[model samples]
Target chain A: MQGKTGSESWQEVWDKSVNGPRALIDCWQEIPCDPCQEACAQGSIVLSSGICAPPALHAETCNGCGKCVAICPGMAIFLVDRSIGSGLARVTVPYEMRDEIRLGGEAWAVDGEGNYLAEGRITRVSGAGRPGRTMLLTIEVPEEWALKVRGVRGRRKLLEEPEEVEAIEAVEDFAFCRCEEIDYSRLREIITQGEFRSLPALRRFSRAGLGYCQGRFCQSILRSQFLADCPEEDREVESFRVRAPVRPVKLSRLGGEDG
Target chain B: MSLPCEQLDLLVIGAGPAGLCAAYEAAAVGCRVTIVDENDKAGGQLSKQIHRFFGSSHHGAGKRGIEIAEELFGDCLKLGVDVRLSSSVLGLFSNGEVMIDAPTQLCLVNPGAVIVATGASEKSLAFPGWTLPGVMGAGAAQTLINIHRILPGSRVLMVGSGNVGLIVSYQLLQAGAEVVGVVDTAGSISGYQVHAGRVRREGIPVYLGHRLLSARGSTGLEEVLVEAIEDGTVKRFEADVLCLAVGMSPLCDLAAMRDCRMVYEDALGGLVPWHGADMRTSQSPVYIAGDASGVEEASVAMEEGRIAGISAAEDLGSLNSGEAAERRAAIAKRLDELRAGPHSRGKLAAKERLYAR
Candidate 1:
């Protein structure tokens, strides 16, 4: 069994890829989740580290059950069988879109990143006409391309690819601080004139981060702007200064006086 | 006249997912809990989320966020937690004094312990004509569409391909608004591929490696100019609404006001109050959880809430040490699982630095 402390290695995953039909989980990220384990009645899926651990399958125990396929919130689980006669593989994927999915039809198969891969024949479609549910689509693909096909989409006209052009200069002056109406031009001038090294210095000189929102909106923007122009050595120490009364309070309130 | 300062055992601020879960855990342990929020309603941003959440069943995965918020709030109420809505905590003093502006009166609270779950706010991107009426945060448009049942505009241009941008774009389409396209500066999709696929299936082109240069109109937003960052190719789309889903920053103002040690963590949405694994800040009586602690999934926030809540309860002698440790271990493991994903490496490291005393 693969230990929970370490992620599943290729050998462990390969060992579980049995000859018959089995579930293939494409989930690589350690998303803290485990509904797939609960969905498997045969106890085929092992979650040694509770819900957050990725589901580990025992090849011998899995019965090609598709319960885990529909329940995965990420829709990363798939059912595949490469040994089903006729040089072809059957791959089942979850579909949640509202498009019309038909059986005995052709669809464009896509890779894990949603890029168009190859065309596959749709053999079966389940859970249609149900609202708020995941539909499973089984497609027949070339045995060589079975592992790569993640999902299928209808043949739609793709937008023209963006063309290459010369680098453009920064556009017209835009406000950096909305509450104070401090635009970018004014910020650049202040940064040079005041020789502001930190956010507090700039805030003290320009009143850019002293608005009602308490620099929540402007601080990040200002930091990005400063870092883009500042020397590399001074970049690490540049950040906003946090102070009290995070919310706007009347002076009377601070004095403990009744409103 | 101002009401005299009231001494309480525990006070939780911002009755969102984290705060609600915190209140529930502490109150379940037979500790008196009083929760306050600025909004008239208890669910903070959870009420505006129409998309189904993703996590284990314990985090309400597969359930819509709105449903989870209702369930969490309901659980807190059933436990007899005192919930004050439209009651904003004006200021949190260094001495543990909390000044609250209730709907009817001004009150001061001196609590034995405080849990700050104030959550995070949407980060905005500025461009020409960005201040136009139709140019707004994606969350604002989501609130308008999902909560208020009003479409922000007819044709929308979404900037940022993160989960919020993708989900809100899908939601906009579901609400009968046309999503012109989604623009992002990154070459690859940043959010989950499943979410990106949902929009791609609908023929909504995701313009990757592109940055929004400007929004233009006479009065309201009418069009947006997007330029490819790689080669500077510019494209313009006619859009009445330009929704920015760039990112979010943790709402740590209250924590900062409490004189808690602060640190700059880019992964945690910039500056955040430093805290330990138990969710207690450097300040003895102050604790924090949820997005306010650091922006993560509501599921992670809920788990952190339980940790903070139980820690407070145990500190106040409401729970035994053995029981608190057991519960903490389970939650810590869950947190580890959540942060186990490769994408969370930076966040996990940032949290480690935060947890270091």
Candidate 2:
């Protein structure tokens, strides 16, 4: 709610809503998809900005339809109801785990970061439906933690700590071309020397783009390296010269000879 | 010994979703169809997809790609459509002659109509240390995990935020590998937010507006360095595998060899053959479908293949014009529906330009 979740932005909708329970479409990104909008039966979810726009919920019209919860491809949607009791609230979230969470079973409620928030009981577990593979799990939590709880712990752990990556001093020494095994340091040296006037000349000398893949993997990198080094006045980087055998054709097949 | 040459009603290339759909449609309508693919097994990349597809149920949505591929392949076999596996179409002549290289022998076939659906290849991204043995295409990683049952590495750094990157990263976790993070040069996540959400909920970080600068290792990929596009600040992470899901380009070499007019459309994944609404290329009696026409999902490719198959069948007089028009109209309407979303507007515009000429 404070940082990346952007759930605080929906405070106005939450404060103004008079409905008993409703769905919160927490999707913040404008990606080209509409399964959530289509999933709602009441047509409360709308994408006014075409297909790629983030879904906007018509709070009053939304009857807390859990349809959007299971259909969301990103699992970004959740249903929250804070007016249920004095301190009790219900939060329904999408679950794709293989092991199903049991109804009325004790489970650990986690926030967006998958950190332990509080222990809650699973109110309901919906089976796979029109939403295809995604299942819905509703958990009753403290009214204050309704917005904070996003998912539940299944048989497998929700989050795993990422491996530690040490900081390296230099990255330019790495290989740029995977197919031809051309390293960036070598290209940097070639560009600094200015011995070659064109990409074709550099390609001929280094054999960077002459791999089995026909330079599909490294031609762009070569061009970028040349552009990065060239002065603004001389910024024209020529394209790679492609030959007829764009795909790898066995020499024996071409010569009509068999092994 | 020289192989025997035979004439067929239709010859479909590539055996992918598009190719299989085209063969099935054409064969169902009583057009003698034969499909060929370079791989020892058919299904193309579909076999490696373990995630559920998005689309209406009519388009095989809600089904995993492997399931759809099995169903299509089963249908093709039941229809008695001749499927030649491990056979690559070596050459395509303007006269409708196709030279096929099979395991046993190299043979030539003259067909009344041809459907080119060679599909697309994964677009590569180059950075320092990208060529290390551990770094590979996201599709290759998918093939290794889902198909070959091999885990690529313990720690994976995905270089792209597109659907492939996001989906494969999740699959990596499912395969018991750790996904360090997903890095993209774009300012925002390019894939569906739901996919990003799934990864985020799993405690994986999605670094938008970050570019992978280089990979470092002695023999294989040992670490990857990424830079924030906005601030130019660099961060290094230990990753045994670097998956490149930058993008894909339509494999159009076969189409180009046949002298089909090629047009550059970035939206359709670069250098695509210009074709009409019927999927007929500039060359008559020759049609193109699936990624060869443009880069799109398997659902769109299947529909395009159906249209091409019906068009080819009509051209051979096996199907009447009236029936062909109805079928084409129905399939076209479904295609329009599938491409109606914001993500598909560019593809729609590209298709419009392709057919406009």
Question: DockQ, per-model, please?
Answer: 0.28, 0.23
Which regions of candidate 2 deviate over 4 angstroms? A1-86, A98-107, A111-117, A123-135, A154-259, B322-326
Q: Write the per-residue lDDT of candidate 2 for residues B1-357, one digit (tens) a residue.
A: 455578988999989999999998888899989999998888988888777676655656546788889999999999999999988887787666788877776678999999999999887765556668899999999999988999989999998898899999989987889888899989887877667767776678888888777777999989888877787777878889999997887887777778888787778887788899999999988999999899987889999999999999999887899999999999998788778766788989998988998
Q: Candidate 2: what lDDT?
A: 0.78
Tens digits of per-residue lDDT for model 1 on B110-211? 999999999998887657777788998899999899788999999898999988999999889778787888999999888876678667756678989988
Which pairs in model 1 have colliding backbones?
A30-B341
TM-score of chain B of 2: 0.98
Model 2, B28: alpha-carbon shift in Å? 3.7
lDDT of each: 0.79, 0.78
lDDT of 1 at A122: 92
